[model samples]
Target: MAMMQKTEILIIGAGVIGICAAYYLTEKGYKVTVVDKGEVCSGCSYGNVGVAVPSICGTLASPGIISKSLKWLLDPESPFYIKPRFNRDLIGWLWEFQRACNEPQMRRGLSILHEFNTASVELFKDLAAQEKMDFGFVQKGLLVVFKSLPGFKEGVQEAELRQKIGIEAEIIRGSELRSFAPHLRSGLAGGIYYRRDAHLDPYKFVRRLAEKTRKKGAQILTSTEVIGFEIFGKAIKTVETTRGDFTADEVVLAAGAWSSEMSRYLGLKLPIQAAKGYSITYRLPENYLEMPVSLSETKVFITPLADTLRLGGTLELAGMDLSINKRRVNAILKTVPEYIDINIENLKLIEIWRGLRPCTPDGLPFLGRCRAINNFIVAAGHAMEGISLGPVTGQLVAQVIGNEKPSVDLSLMSIERFN
Candidate 1:
């Protein structure tokens, strides 16, 4: 261990949340340092569907989650499949998820998500423009298409719930949906359109944000592992990292999938499991420059990037592991045929990535001061929303350190909810 250095605020996990936190804090005139174990933005924050979906306010464990599991459990390639791994934590997490899937819990969970996500949408747009970051942000919105009429009807009902909360949703017929973005194959039923949501190139988004933060004088130290923390009387004294020991007035734990281990080191019991997801990008064949679209029936998200069509979707409830499962990757490829007539055999796979989504039992992130210790705050367990919620999470973190009002009510997302 090296000798101790000092910072006004220290952030672990240099992904979107950590980077964003550093940016906001530094603007508030605080000395900040950000550290990460691996390459920055290589986690789930970098490679998701890339949708800032304020419209998707439902909990990960919804009313039909238990019922849906029955049909998906047998299919290895199902959207929500659980492996037969004999892991106690994974089993316990599933149980916790089931408990939260009740009717009342669904309403409560989605309501909370709605507020945070909506606030994040506005915040992210503001940051991108003011910071001059070209994150490929387009407010063209997302169109979810389906092949089954029943699925379309159900999706409309779900969109109705979003509209009730002031989210704009246009229930379009198959022809109308395709007309607005004519790229998918035929036989598409109707789907709900969330005009308020937006999408972006996640890779560009993170990189540009980090670049802008660095320009604004936020030091992002990559490959710096936080070995352990120093706490005294409910305040974080120092964070011991591989590079050096740094003392700070406050610290934010934004380590994503690796957050569970960090929480254990801090003596906090945060039940977060690493759910792995895979994405494959294919170069555009021709004239596919339309807005990104998601296939509702297959749970596949195909977003159009600057020069390629990136198709990614699949949630594997694995541990803190990163071994790429060939089957899961293939499952994502299988959805391509259902959506569009891509040149599958000839298309090049620009990348094959597997990042862990730091998932909680109820699909809500823990964001607040650690009750056990005041100086230690948590901003992890974001799961699939790490990128989408990064800006808002960062702003809220700065607010806490500044002793200001938060943008949204964080009662449900508080770390105390776990206790």
Candidate 2:
């Protein structure tokens, strides 16, 4: 018979969400074990643009998304592209996404998402301060630079919606904007500046976080695959893995893109879909950069690390496959030179990677315990905003374990919303 070693809790996936949950749970004295099919901090959590952007509460599918999506469908090299494939799941997910973009749906999404993201940023600050992790985090603020008056007006509307939810942002145009990032090309018009927003070197951020989590008495398991679940009535009794079988009093399904397949064992089919994203990093000039920024019009993000510069952003609705589309990668790289004078010729491509963002139909993550099961909580499907929501997601998991009220209300993000 296999030795059934019992743990207080078992968390699947070693991504930021999982690690954050482990950090908080262990702090509260829970005997927790986190299992991943692969290495810790080596998944989608690694490849994000690394923004602490609370103001991006407005989802990708917004007021004009239907028309914009139609336009995007026709263009191959657009910022957000949906590659045509005969996969039923992928096609079905797209339809659900379209359905989730209506006015009432988007309004609900913004309300829930903004609250979650704002809480997350605060949690991040507290943990980073206590942990003393140097991840090149800058609270200097974020600027959404635009190249035309129409785009600037659109930026203002976004800022306005963000303001309605208490996100501190302002519309800046002309000389005020030019003075901020003087290197911007002469063809620029204006932008929106979210004063509360922040950025970090994403790769270094995740690497340091994982290392810090491990040093703080949490186990870091790499190259381990969670094969199946050991369900005992309403509770998960064990987490079956390729390496070994271990019992768990509770489990959190923070498995990112793999949550749908993994959740099936529990008789729950999470409508989570994998939205693939790409990013590339290049060398920063020795004596350069006024401030790290994201080009709003181009949808390209640049984060200034301690020494290197990370540029990332590009969403493709392709299924779960690790194959890199060099064409798509090139499509992202083409935008950098349009906004500012950066030496792309001299800088070598330090890294190029893809991550699958676990997306839900309504663009809100499924958080807290489900009505269908007990002791099997879920906290995945943040899509492009996982990094922005990691800390709070973890805190919420810990609160649920402690049987306390979560700092933020998650009723709107309940898994039953889909059902």
Candidate 3:
């Protein structure tokens, strides 16, 4: 090892969550060091839809999700899929997922997510207002367009649920749907417009925040993969990495999809599964959308960033696999033209990105400190909401490490919840 580097706090993972944690820790005057296996924002945070939607307060394991998943399994281009696997963790995760697929659990998860996302959006506004920071943050709201009557009905019910939770959801029907977004196709049943939602370039946000953290004297070690850990008693004394070894007073496991695998080295079993999602970015079309829109039935999201447009969707429970499925990508592209009046195939291509989002069984993230390890904390498993919840999660992690009470109640997001 190269002389055993030392710091007050060591955060593994340079994605949005980890970078935000470093940012807040540095602001708190803590000597923080962040190490990642790849470059900053090189994972799930890079190619996500980048929408912070508080109106989407539903859990992934909703009442009808199992049936829906089963139906989607038959279609190769379905929005959701679970590869048949004999893994013990996958089996256990499904069992927990099944248990959580109830109204009570879904409502409880939604309440927490609503709080997290709402608070994070405010934090995002604060970050955006900072001088020398511009990540294309825009609060133009989002629209969920439905093509089928059945899907529109379900969307109305979801909007009602969101209203009950204090979220503003406006239903635009008939000609109003096209009036809301003139570029949309005419056959749309309706759309639910969420005025509180916002979108940004996720990669820009993370990298910009990382730059600000560096300027604040925080150390960020890229291309440094964690190999193992030296646990003494109940605390991690040293983190062994590919480059060398390092010791810190506190360690955060924010390795996104890889957090579960990393936790095993510390003798903790985090019930987090890697959900693979794909995104296709293209050069901004002449008739670009003013706001992000979701295809309700197809589960695809179309977001227009600064100079490019991104179409992203699908949830594949393929266990850390990063391979891109051409059929699934094609399905997303094909579904876009059904709602929007745009020729996707002719658009200039930017990139096709695939990332593994860390997802927990109950559709909740694993936050807060670990029970077994005194100095270890977890901040992973945000799944699709990683960008939405990044800032708040980082602030909460800083609060926990600083021995201050967390702003939001983290009991529901306990790292040992599955246990």
Candidate 4:
């Protein structure tokens, strides 16, 4: 083993959260070190739709989500599919998720997520302006188009609920929706426009953020897998990796889907499971969308980034498996032409990306410090909002380490909530 090197702060997982933590800590003059098992943005951070949705900051474990999942269970191409497996964690996660599907929990989650995403969007704009980074950060808003009347009514109700909570949500019904956005196909019923939402190229944002952090004097070690840890009574003394041993005054676990396993090293239980999702990117044709849109019934997200278009959706709970499900990808592809006019035959594929989103059962991320470890802080389990909420999570992680009061309350994000 190489001689044990020390850092002021060491962060595991060089995804968006970990890299963002490094950025903030480095800006604060802390000697930070970031380690990742793969290249930067190689996980869930890369293939996401790159949407910054503040209006629809609702929890995944909503009241009707379980029933909806049941309907989708038989359909392999459904937007949400959970494999009928016999795993202890999956069963436990589903049970806990079901328990949290009440009005009270969903309301609490909406309030918390609203605050996080709102702050995150402002931070993203500020960072882009100050850093002069052009990641196609556009604030043109998001449109959720529904084809069925029942779906449109439900969507309108949801939009009204969001409106009541101070979000700018407007309904465009019937022919008004078609006239408002002529690019949409003829069969669309209506749509909800969220003016507060924004988007960017997630790949560029994460990679550039990593580059900026490295330039700010943070040490980034890629392909360095963390195998074990040396723990004292209430702190992590050393982080043992495949490369070498390293000690840090403070440590952060932001390994996303792998966080559950990483917590075991410190005798902590983090209830996070890998919720796999897929995205297919293609070179945009003429008259492509200027902004991002969501297919309400199909639950597929279509985003335009520069000259390319990306379509992504589906939540497949199949443990830590990284395999791509062709059915799910086809589901996304097939759902696009139903809403938008596209030439399916002439479409050229850029890449098919599949990633594991670290999801907590209650549809809330596990942030803040662990009760078992003094120097360790967790910043994982943001689920679908991992890309959207990256900046604020990083800012809060730094505040936690600096012994400063956090910008947002951490009670709801505690890792010990399961206990």
Q: Write the per-residue lDDT of candidate 4 for residues 1-419, one digit (tens) a residue.
A: 57998998999999999999999999999999999999999989988999997887778999988788899999999999888879888888888999999988898899889999999999999889988888889999999999999999999988887777799988998688877778789878899999899999999999998998899899999999999999988889999999999999999999999999998877788889898999999899888768899998988999998899999999999888998889789888888888888866698899999999999999889889878888999999999999889999999999999989999998899889987
Q: What lDDT, from 0 to 1, does candidate 1 have?
A: 0.81
Worst 10-residue lDDT window for candidate 1 reads 177-186
Flag the better candidate by TM-score, 1 or 3: 3
Order of all candidates by lDDT, from best down to worst?
3, 4, 1, 2
In terms of lDDT, the poorest run of 10 residues in model 4 is 174-183
Candidate 2's TM-score reads: 0.94
Can you write out model 3's per-residue Cα lDDT over 355-384, one digit (the tens) per residue?
A: 998989999999898878999999999988
Residue 162, candidate 3: C-alpha displacement in angstroms: 0.8
Q: What's every prediction's RMSD, in angstroms?
A: 1.6, 1.8, 0.9, 0.9
Q: In candidate 3, how many Å is residue 409 off?
A: 0.6
Candidate 2 lDDT tens digits, 353-401 = 8899998877888888877678788999988888888888888999987
Ten-residue stretch with the least lDDT total in model 3: 52-61
* Model 3 stretches with alpha carbons more than 4 Å out: none
lDDT of candidate 2 at residue 394, scale 0 to 100 = 89
Cα deviation in Å at residue 106, candidate 4? 0.6
In angstroms, give how far residue 396 of model 4 lies from its true place.
0.4
